[model samples]
Target: MARASVSPAPPRVSAPDLPRHLKRVEPARGADLLQATLHLSGDVDLAHSSLEQCLLTADAERVDLTGATVLDVAAKDLRIASMSLRNAGIRRLRITGGRIGTLDLSGSRLDELEIRDVRIDYLTFGGAKGSDILIADSTIRTLDLPQAEITRMAFVACRSDEVDPRGLRAKDVDLRGLDAEMFTDANGLRGTTLTTFQIQKLAPAIAAGLGIQIKD
Candidate 1:
């Protein structure tokens, strides 16, 4: 894990009290983004430019931006409520630290996406297509994996809100450091793709699928 070189540190605050709707504007071009720290109080818009090591601390609101781009933006140790990325042409976007309420990734494409040391409530990968999706040391509320294709994926030290059978879809899926409830649907369970605890959690669903009734 590489440390961010942009801003020294974000503004430290105790929780937040914001309205339901909030918006703020910040330009990515010529904003000293190389080592710049942005203290966002409400919704933030960071569109356009080459931002490397830029830190954004928002009030857990939706981050809306489009058309702007970046080369290697390392966002670490920041709290964001939600993020709305549409028509963004970004590459090598690494998200680390902080918790997002909802991450709506619709109509956005990326390369080499890595998420580590973050806590998110709802992660909607719907209509999102990318390569090399890796999630590690994170807490996910509900993972909606539909239409999002990945060549390589890994889930390490990760916890989910619910064991959604439809929450998983991948060509090469790696499940390690996971809980058993991640796979409760017997029919949707893949082959040889679970750990000991996971197997124990899905045993009842598997038995029920096999028409076996336990005599309590």
Candidate 2:
């Protein structure tokens, strides 16, 4: 029995080794993809363009980055369904492999992001903030971090059922790849970093939501 982790200690996100021979884009005919690499299909509208070191690939069913200003972009092998970066301003982004149903960054402003081996159904970083973020081997069904103020996010070998961290203020988050069942507001998981079998399997639903009575 050697389980040590007084939380706070997860911020080594890595994934943004760009540059694999670029130059080949098509910003909906309005050209200009920084360090280019995009191959469009259907809908696209780089709203208030200003991307840098960009790189997006393959198909696109819909996309309208409202107030774009992405820096160091990357979305390899994309096959988007609906992407609406409402109030975009991302920095150093990276969205790996394909498959996205809906990704709506509400009032965005994320910095240093990463989403490897994707397959998202619906992801919404409601009122985003910034810091080092990473989500590896993803497979999210619905993950909406409402009022997000991310500091240092992390989720390796990820998997989500339907986790909506209400007023999420990730102060060095790292849920040990929780693979949640469901959670709209488990106190927004304070300042994450779970492991100890994931807090003993969520400690009986977090002690029945804090009513506390574990004497069964």
Candidate 3:
């Protein structure tokens, strides 16, 4: 009496033609490099790639990065000057220890976006619509969220000075950090979190949202 046996399936591989100076990329359907310098042209979609340390500097029109998981991807030294992300979907994005200079994410959507230990000079999340955006332990110079609609956003342990929210509309915005004085509100500060000392930094125009009169 004999029995039948079965073999396991081998791993899937799609090798790429790497450059001599720069390494080649054999990117998976939703998985990619851990650390590499990538140069792209046209629409680049590395969605759901668990990128560790990536250096991406491109002038592409639409970089389709949706539903991607970014861990420890440092863009702190990226000097794109001014870049735009249009109609791109960003979710579950985790950034740590990076330098971002002038990033404009208008007309984009973010879901569960988490940023930490980063220093951004000029960042604008304007005209963006999404939820659960957490920015913690970061230092930003100028952040403009004007005309942006956010849901369940949290800014924890962040230090900033110039935060412009001319037409900012948020739901459940949390500002729990040492430097929460930089935040100003025109619409209001309802469903927001802050300490008593942090609330003292708001001006008459900004404090109107919280129904508090500032003494000049």
Candidate 4:
């Protein structure tokens, strides 16, 4: 007997729409914006700008904030192709939901970086220094944190396809609710805290790394 043909999966849905009637502001150096809604279309260069409780709708292809300072900012509901924060300082950087292609924070300093409910294609924190970093309720395709100096790193209810934490030096690493397909160079997380369930899930990988055979 011949079997029936299966239908193909549907295409992925696009991100949500951005807010309308966002006030346009001239990109200036050291500008302080509070509770403002700004929109960007082309490449944005915000050097030394302070954003407090502001909503940024990034429709731009690239956002370059080299040598800038961002605080208490929330970015959501937009599609940014690329974001670069080289040599910038960020505190309380909360990104709730959005679709970001790539984020490069090389040589930057961050106090608190919180990312929740977002989808990122690629993210790199190489040569970056941060204190508290939390990634909760997000889906990341690839995350690279090589040579990062993070004090506290927590991954709560996050899923990642690939996480490369090689050369990462963190004081406290907590992996409470993380479901990763592949953790490259997992030895970087030697001092991390994992629950019994997480350990059970990673038993095969741990055993392979330690050259221990599991017999039935």
Candidate 5:
């Protein structure tokens, strides 16, 4: 997947602490959007398309962008039942204020992405590769990351009922602000950042993984 020569690559996100509430410059309210392509303005089936520097806001039951190469896009207030970006290459994308039943990014390559204020029932990154991704101020019912290689990802002020992290290859994945009920593979959390309080809260489960029993 290739990005346009006009759009520069985002800087690398370092370890330990991640920037909070980072945002791009949004277009002025009611400004002429003729320059910016309004994707999903007409067709919903945009599979295998190369969409660049677009703006979209919609309410749909299902929207598919499978195998698409999306770059430098800003979307807001998207209410969808299911949104799929499977096997796609997405870069420098921002999404806010959305409610989705399911968001599938499995087997995709996501870079420099930010998703905030969205409530997703199921969000999956299975078998995907990602970097510099942030999901803040979101409520997700399930976050599936199995077999995913992710770098510099953070979940700030987010809550998830379940996070399946089996076979996860991660670096600097901050979970300090995430309140997750379960992690299917506790050991898959290695090389990720977690606050002391979070680790203490999961002490029992961690001990159980090591076959250590604590008597009450």
Candidate 6:
């Protein structure tokens, strides 16, 4: 009988190294935070409050905001790592000039989300619903929207490396000023409204997907 072969073990994945200042603290309900740095764990509820220049780091749990408003919030070196928001009903939420790593928003509803001059890595909106989601002057590495519903999504002067729109139900998606390098599923944008220039930019990708040869 032949000897059975044993596969090698896979490499272990480790979590990110958090800073010393990131502690587990809870904020007052409906408290306003300005120019503060806090490391939080578990669920956080900041309902009906405003935050400006706030550096916040949270654990794997979701940040709950039943009704809150966030404006001009940023972290040290303008980078936020591993933040998740769930069931957050936010009004006038604006994140200007920051770098976010692993930002997840699930089952949340936002009136306006204006992310400007920011860099995001692994941004996901899973099972969340939003309207008027705008990303301006930003660079996103990976944008994943699985089973999410978005209405009137617009990208202005923004660039994205990969946009995975699997099971994403969006209406009126405007990509006039967007420079997307790769779209995982072009058919996912079947009902999207794009400008003539935008269509021209994506012609090559579209042709490649359809396996059509463009002969001059």
The candidate maximizing TM-score is 5
The 0-to-1 C-alpha lDDT of every candidate, in the order given, reads 0.59, 0.79, 0.59, 0.74, 0.77, 0.64
Model 6 segments more than 4 A misplaced: 1-78, 195-216
lDDT of 4 by residue, 38-120 (tens): 77668887766776656677778988777777766667766799987787888777777888899888789987788878888
- For 40-92, candidate 1 gives per-residue lDDT tens digits of 54666664444554445556465655544544555666577877555565566
**How would the candidate models be sorted by TM-score, starting from the highest?**
5, 4, 1, 6, 3, 2
> Can you tell me which runs of candidate 3 are displaced by over 4 Å?
1-80, 178-181, 184-188, 206-216
Q: Estimate the TM-score for candidate 6.
A: 0.63
Better of 1 and 6 by lDDT: 6
- For model 5, the superposed segments whose C-alpha errors exceed 4 Å read 1-43
> What clash count goes with each model?
3, 0, 4, 1, 0, 0
Query: Which has the higher lDDT value, candidate number 2 or candidate number 6?
Result: 2
TM-score of 4: 0.76
Q: Which stretches of candidate 4 lie over 4 Å from their true place?
A: 1-24, 28-36, 47-53, 197-216
lDDT per residue (tens digit) for residues 1-216 in model 6: 997642221112122233335333456567876656666555565656565445555442444444455544433324555555555654445566767676667677755566778888888877778776777888989888777887767787988898887788877667666787777776666646667876776787788779988889
What is the C-alpha lDDT profile of model 3 across 1-216, one tens digit per residue? 686532111112111222334454644436767656665445556655555455455544444444455443333333344444444565444555656666666767766666667777877887888676767788888888888887777676788777777677766666655374456564545445667666656655555766787675
RMSD per model, one decimal: 10.5, 13.1, 12.9, 11.9, 9.5, 16.7
The local lDDT score (0 to 100) that residue 50 gets in candidate 3 is 57
At residue 82, give the lDDT of candidate 4: 90
Pick out the ten consecutive residues of candidate 4 with the lowest summed lDDT.
Answer: 7-16
Query: Candidate 1: RMSD over Cα atoms?
Result: 10.5
For this target, which candidate reaches the highest lDDT against the unseen true structure?
A: 2
